[model samples]
Target: MNRPTSLVSALSLALASNAHAATAADAGAGIHELQRVQVTATRSERAIADVPNTVDVIERERMDELLVRDLKDLFRYEPGIAVGSSFGRFGLGDIRVRGLGGNRVRIQTDGIPVSDAFSIGSFSNANRNFVDLDTLKRVEVVRGATSSLYGSDALGGTVSFITKDPADYLQEGKDAYFGFKLGYEGSWDGLFGGATAAFGGERWSGLVAIGHRQGQEIENQGEVGGVGSARTKPNPQDRDGRSVLSKLVFAASESRRFRLTVEGNEDNADTDLLTSQGLQALTGAFNDSVVAEDRQTRARVAFTHEMDAVDAGFADSLDWQVYRQDSETTQYTREIRSGLAPPTLRDMREREFNFDQRMYGVQANFRKGFVTGGVQHELAYGLDLARTETRQKRDGLRTFLVTGVSTPVMLPDVFPVRDFPISETTTAALYVQDEMSFVDGKLRLVPAIRVDHYKLEPDVDNIFAEDNPGVAVSDISETSVSPKLGAVWHFADDWSLFGGYSRGFRSPPYSDVNIGFTNVQFGYTAIANPELEPETSDGLEAGLRFSGDAVYASVSAYYNRYEDFIESMRFIGFNDDGLMVYQSQNIAEAKIHGVELKAGVDLGALSEKWRGWSLRGAAAWSRGEGKGPEEVEVAPDVFEEQIVTRNLDSVDPLTATLGVVYQRDAWGAELAGRFVQRKDRVSDPSYYRQGGYGVLDLYAHWEFAPGARFNVGLFNLADRKYSEAGDVPVVGGASATLDRYTSPGRNLSASLSVNW
Candidate 1:
């Protein structure tokens, strides 16, 4: 476990992308009919199959049909992506793309970066993938290595979510489109409900969306511990979440338009779980018991304007948008336990952490047609700028037991969460891009360049955080650059080819800059190097697409070389007090590669008399490996030590799906099979290994009643028992780079809806 030429070693162990899932009815016109596909993958509308990249776009109807509760549900259909790979009933996960997850992935909503802009080694700093999936109209996934026009965490590619837009479906002269739904479950005693209402006129429109979800403790299902598998005691936990999305758009003229949108969401929950080394996961249950409480709120306001033929005549339909984003959250931590485990008479401890961030930015674009070589050609250009400010605070009372890992405990009754006041982070970015087409539109090319500048002033958190005492680490400010280039060739109406390459990076995160540790190995003294470099990746992607009136298929391949991958490495250091500390620093590298293929056929032509019956299936498979000598995939920095496995677990492999979508005038139904290839790469204690798995789902909807409709669905129809990964990166500096989190059996849900 002591050698790694790069920051990480990873490949083929089932690497998937951060898939945002939302199901809807067939893209058809009628409630149960197939609708036309109008996607915006290139910042322009077109069919998903027509887009050159290996992209998956899921619509609102499909989203509804799937009854997607959160983003991680992708494992149900989309094979390669597993948000909470090891998500047990709790559903926590690390979004992975290519071979990297957590912060290495980039996410955006309405083209604005929502990831904690705080530098955390060139990826999301939360390391905790944070997008809540409820408020989405559609999710567009750009798979593989990307020199994507976007900069930042996009090194491993990007996932952009488009919130519901009210204009798309509203009738030309209709004033309103309203809908509502409710659902419940038995496992966690869960209940969910939502409502949407929109009103629009000749030149203006508005919409309001509201929703709520609540659930009690989930059944542990014996994955944590077991004899044969029985109901685990209910942990004292409950959760409630809600959101409101509102927007207004104005059509100024035939060639001008403007829009404004505001969104707000909040989640509050109380959780109960046990910590391996003697920490309670929740607060309250008893005087000496621990529990956890979390609360968060996010708000944003955005404005957009579109105008054709600016005064200078240098453009056509100019587009621009400006926005603000703010968020605040707090966590209360503690843990409680019962009979199965021995009590350490642990003293109660309470910890609270708060975070706030503010960001503002704007972008402008132009497109025009020009005469070239006696032929007409198109020209496009765009630019964007943004600035952000972030603030964080930690306040808590933690109890530490000087006793054994088991039984007896409670030496210290209470301690504050952090001995520091607060810290601040700020960032800014700007970029420009352009696209040109030749041969009368048979060939197209795009090139883009972006520059990002970062600065940070991290305030320490330890009571003795500085030279005065036991401080483990701190944050520093640094700047980095990202650039990209790409091209697309339209060889025929039914086929096209594409290639893109770029250099990308995500700044270091809060935990990477602040978390402190003890213990070291001389030259390996891991300390937060405020001077640490940004995690960087150079990536390339190529793909082909074939589509005709009724059939579609796509093949894509990607590769990336990652540097300063920012993983935990041992650092040796001695405080003025002579207490040696081992901290986390930017020191790692990884080579990520993969190939994906997706295809489907329409059975309408062959099924004939069946009228509404058509069948199709899509699949993806990818494999990778760690690069260079010494540089192996290092586990999270939590574990102090671990035995090196025979080899690193590659989460990437073959994944496929088969299903049928039936389209009848009054009813629609679907049946599908989900599969994961048998895991051949094995690592860890003799008892742990991965095997293949398959699950079935059935869904149907009836809309004979005009604005009224109903639907029924069965997930894991056979009640299959299987284990999915909930990859937990250890925190205490243990070399145990990966821990498998498991899942429970299966369940079902149904819903009815009304629209006007």
Candidate 2:
């Protein structure tokens, strides 16, 4: 188990650590005394100092005390982890650890898989996460694959959201409270509303909370055609948008609790990258619009019960979840792609799909006081089974008022601009895990295996249209098994070492193998290729952790061998026009390796002038390479030289964070600095490497009264000009419609919270 470091490493540390011990520890406690910290990523509530692996946690108070609004802000003190995409609004942030992102990483809410069977395709929206930030108590980020508590994507790593439970505010152990959030400024202008209430008696407890935010206009960093970077905003249409979220919970009995939640969010956004004639033309991300509207609704039921079972198990817990999403989208726009004809009105497309999923799991665990050859042994074993099914009511219509030289096709009901075929899919998996602790709980070993069976059935004739729209369809099925092994050794009371090896996979997308293009009247379509392989990876991870009340530090590194990657290629035919047709292909292998280190030391008071002073922070660096077609087609030619996620990400490979906060019983203020080098490295051949940048954020908080508090913060204080991620797309022909979505320039917001 990874535990916090002791007061000091050696006898010499006792004196050096004692100086700051009073500041890091509570005022009334011993210098090394530590507050209780509990973590549950292992499917059990245990001490953080006892878990031996690379992990990072951000509690609700810390995130709020710093006035943090974005997920990227947490990455400062954290290393080897990154949040993909900035638009989740707490409902959709993707995670990447050790440079393995997207489907490779698993996102969960209470141990349930977040993705569905249709989680595929470029720009695919996976994990319809409902755990909005307003309702979160904390998040546990397990780096690497030390423990596959869940299945599949866990091979890369696991990021799970643990919701806030009811808190007792009553002097008799019962409490109730409510609050609302509304904000307006240049950067993120929105109206947020929230309420929370909880009840706790000697033997019963309950909690409920809800939050929603509607926003408009995102801050601008720099516009391609703008005269200066000072005010880089686009036309009124570019920055207009809005979103919302809500949550609720109920509980009865000490070990049995249930939560019923009906929450959803909708966004009407401008696909601004599509341009008529602008600098974006140089990047090739055709600037064109057609507004996009996406919405999702989720209903979940979860119950946790602990029992001293007949099987001699000390504790057993069961969990079940039912998730649903009704997705509808429509696009309206016109574009003369070839410029050979008048701006012809693009075909109108619309898509609506319904997804309902259910997952039930039970774990029977035991921690018995047993003697193994005079040495104690504690073992936990459990079996897991989950099944998912999806049925959709789909309808799409696309017709050419007049066929142009080059015709463009879209997926079923693709909105006003394109049309595509519709299909249904179902998937299931089963798994088992065993963890044994011996030598008096000083050492632990866990082994897990999961088997999954996936199948997709689609009707070709109906999907392609009775008019013979050129589209191919097929039925397909596949199965796979993944194994994971891990061990943790508690070297001492305050230090531990751990390592693990695991395998994971990304099943081939049904659309790529089962769906094909159609020419309709042309009688030509890219034939469906049902023979496909899933993208897989085998990973190994190791790390050490040390903890104490005043000083806590950890370092971890991991390596992964990724094989059978799925990629799209130009294997299909091209029309007489310059346009080309592309099909999916199985591609080359890849590898990623990296090291991460983070430590915090409480810098105590230096003099009377520096009383109440404290300092803490961390730093990290990482890199990787592609070994297949990616290397040959992109990056440098050599396999070792090809930059992988370890390098191709938005920011630089080297990054770090530092912050200082001074707090008393009632007030606190802090200043934090972050540095992210520009990606001097690039996969594209066009632009020279980009320049790196650094930013400073400041936060302050004041207790207005016993139950009320006010917080104010300034972000991008230097008003730095930076891009969100690389605007350039590698691995293909150059095009001018590239997207240049940049970060906000400078903005300020004040949030006030009251607890009662």
Candidate 3:
């Protein structure tokens, strides 16, 4: 990683050269100011260049050109971000930013938070990849801590998805409109289509959209065919999904408006695992079959009033909203095995697991503008309240057949009935921020703060603790305060320098605090810890930005420190049944630092022949370390960690993306490449080292008519075979046979849409 001084110097020199050259060549072409990128995730609408933090916005046009089908595909070219799936698990994956992931990042849509983190057995629901991409109008990604505004789970960053409203579909000077789209993906042998209808009258407007897709299993490059020759290839499965979105808006007057939105999504898949070597080994059976289903539904209502129209003295506008979200995941599996003995005992096992989460919340915001001491100011204050409920259940049955005679048998549960009891959590928060400008708008400062309070109550009677009747489970409560300060100096007409300090914190989830389970056969038990504290962090960032007629660039560097980091810990003492005990505890302190660079150039300003040509690129590098105890097994079933060691779970390899685009008349095309550096820093036992590789992508779109268009995308153009550094390798095999999860090979997709 480059130091701050070197980075600044390099960017300054490039800006000088690019500005002069562009100005000299396009002297008669007139000045072309860069387009202002607007963002709303900051609690208020502001241009990205004016904000004191790193933010990226993906507009509707860019989204359509990329032919994105899912959240994973949407972030393929984004810097400082990586998306990948867990090994051997379908429909399970997460997004990592600045070397941090899981529950550390907050995901929201239209200012409403989604489902809570839920994990049980082989099924996990931490990732928020359930939303439909077609229903989104734009996406905003804020890098670094946003806890000062979003509360907990904003330690790493925030990703907000803005859904489309009826106004988005209603064309200018039009009262009614409709659109239809058809798409196909070659790799998955998939076909999908969608239709949208919207209409608006004098005071009422409504829009409805429906989309459906069905496909076979995803395709991979398969095994390397050397040491792991016996390992079976990826399993084949049948998959299908559907999503619906509808919104209604009422405009009583120019000063007030009301809106209501409803959305639903469902996905199902069935896997034939008879040829999966990893599954066979994990189940200790010859053949296995699995079926999975996931669903999400949400409804939201919002109202906005202009205080100026109402003659309010202290506020400019007021916005309030309430929402309800529900999510559920269910999995069923069956395993069969035959024993080589005299009676030839055939054992069959069947298991079913279900997990569900529901959330309801209401929030209101007030915006006001004022002036003091010859300085201009904008203030925003808000209050948030929400509650969440989580539930999980598991059941298993085993039967044996001897000499062609069926016999019932008693067997230990494959998955414990419950680790944590069903729980309900309530949260309330108050937040405020002020933007102040001085020195005739040349210098600006922003100060913000937020206070959050939460309570957790667990159902002790429903807990699944074995041989531990006296297990204690109590209610937990905590409060956190986060503060942030930022400043930006517009030193030059087209350039600026910005920096900020922000604080973040995350309270332990219900599963982590009230975690309790006992596995008699495995001789292991996990106990609840009510004394756990929240993980807190403080971060500082500095950056420079330049916007010219033909050039735009941004460079930033940040450092973050964390305390009371929560992680699972194992105790040396044994229970009455001689089972090892583990609990979640505050056990570590850590630090992370990273740098990001992004630049773009307009080729049309340099020459006439390349009038529609453009070049753009982004790069990021990050590293992190922590101090914690290293548990060492002194004797059988005994552990000790007298000496502290360095933790390396926060390090991520360098990543970069470069692209070229051309647009002329009604035709457009883009070619881009992504590169990942080799990762050899194996400081963590759970992470696997991976080699570096690069892949290219091609996209093109054409408007054959005024309201008709066609688009095509060819991803992984080189058919390069590789895996991300953070992907875990498949287990249940010898070390030599274990290999990093393989990514999808070359794939092609195309779509056509018509509007009227």
Q: Top lDDT: which candidate number?
A: 3
lDDT of 2 by residue, 1-756 (tens): 111111101100100000111222222221221222434435555555445455566667665665544455444446456654433111224555765665556766655556542332323333434345656666677766532345555656777766766543335434555554444344657555566666655555555565555565454554444321222344233322223333333444554454544433333443332223322344332323323333444444544444433343443444444444343322222322222234353333333333334444343333334455745544444444554443323333444335533332343223221122344555566655555677777887767776666666765445355423554556768787877787788888777887788777766655456444444344344545577777677888787866664566666677777776655332445655433455665654556676666655544433445455555555556665443332223334433223233233322366666666676666767676666665555433343444466777787777778878777878789988765332322312343322234567777867788766
C-alpha lDDT of residue 306 in model 2: 42
lDDT, candidates in the order shown? 0.57, 0.50, 0.70
| Clashes in predicted model 3 | 0
The order of the candidates by lDDT, greatest first, is 3, 1, 2
| C-alpha lDDT (0 to 100) for residue 246 of candidate 3 | 88
TM-score of every model versus the real structure = 0.81, 0.76, 0.89
Off by over 4 Å in 3: 1-36, 123-126, 224-232, 275-285, 288-310, 340-345, 401-416, 463-468, 633-650, 684-687, 729-740
- TM-score (C-alpha) between model 3 and the true structure: 0.89
Q: How much is 551 displaced in model 2, in angstroms?
A: 1.7
Q: Deviation in angstroms for 403 in model 2?
A: 17
Q: Over the stretch 349-424, how does candidate 1's per-residue lDDT look in tens digits?
A: 4445565767788877666666756455455556666666555544444343434233222222122333222445
User: Which candidate order results from sorting by TM-score in descending order?
Assistant: 3, 1, 2
